[model samples]
Target: MKESSATLRDLRPTQFAVGMIHVRRKMAETRAVCADSRYAFMEQRAIAVVRGPGGVLHVIDHHHWARAWIELGIERAPVQVKMDFRDLDDIDFLAAMMERGWVHPFNERGEKVDIGTLPPSIAQMPDDPYQSLAAFLRIARVFENPGEFNAKFAWADYLREHVSGDSGTIEGFAEMLATAFRFAHTPEARALPGYRPEAAR
Candidate 1:
């Protein structure tokens, strides 16, 4: 319930993995969009965080942006507190976050992980290739809604089931993306977030 600016180093990530491709994309954008002044760019993008046990600020969104700032050696960004669960114990705090869709404690392979093992910071979060694919799918305007919390992660889970054999190369990602794009339009994907059934035709 508070909004303020905070140093990037202090913002803890709520997930164990991020689409590294997406992070790299943001990195490139940082140089292009905010090259003149990172601070000014940050002022325009305020990430959302929830106060957890011991008053830790857990990032709920814009995980890529936070990583970009730290990698670019930028110091801080504006953060808006969406909730305060500090009064709850560690277990209860995490439960609240998950219930509110504020935390996604899944790994690259779309496996559920203990929330306690969430990356200590955004910089340490590992890569989730399917996550990258899901993000690009969103950008392609291939679906609808796209508003629920962690919706992209939901797509990531779906992609993980339909696509496989990631070589972790750009070319490999392109191949996977092509396949995923097709699978995205199928009836099975209709249940996922941001599904525009008409887009299939």
Candidate 2:
């Protein structure tokens, strides 16, 4: 099968986390929240973004290309977003491969077989991997373990240390993009795309 277009590595830092939040919220709204849904999966794939010369982002189905669009009030509105998870098959295959390694292959007799090095059963990928990852990090914090999230932050800090003191517009712009995506446009808007109000009962 082809590669997934919504893998975690394909997502930017902010987009990665926000995507998890979005999926979680959507599951809740759609009344699809289940024991298995608690953990969202991030399929391996590519995501892209189309931007103009001025760094002004454009709208397109970059779901298979980039993490998410970070519209910084460019055109004529407060802010806009276009996130796409156009593929899921690749992710499933990779996840299965990660655990069993022989999800799809031919043997000497041309028969399907499980000869992967890893275990046979792969854990369900998290429905909201970012949120699940964050929660796990928090649990680590509570247990006095090394902070997984903070480690990433520290890495960023280290990178900044070697850079010049005068940060430019792109940095600020990216930060703004992250800030806007973190919060919901409105309370009603917080509902995920497929969420349903009647499911609460």
Indicate which candidate wins on lDDT.
1
Give residue 174's error in model 2 in angstroms: 2.7
lDDT tens readout by residue for model 1, 91-130: 8886787787777767776788887778788889888888
**Top candidate by TM-score:** 1
Off by over 4 Å in 1: 34-37, 144-146
Which consecutive 10 residues in model 1 have the weakest lDDT in total?
Answer: 142-151
Global lDDT of each model? 0.82, 0.27
User: What is the Cα-based lDDT of residue 161 in candidate 1?
Assistant: 88
lDDT of 1 at 15: 81
Query: What is candidate 2's lDDT per residue for 127-152, written digit by digit as tens?
Result: 22223222222233311214222232
What is the C-alpha local distance difference test score of candidate 2? 0.27
Stretches off by above 4 angstroms in model 2 are 1-63, 66-169, 194-201
Instruction: For candidate 2, report its TM-score.
Output: 0.16
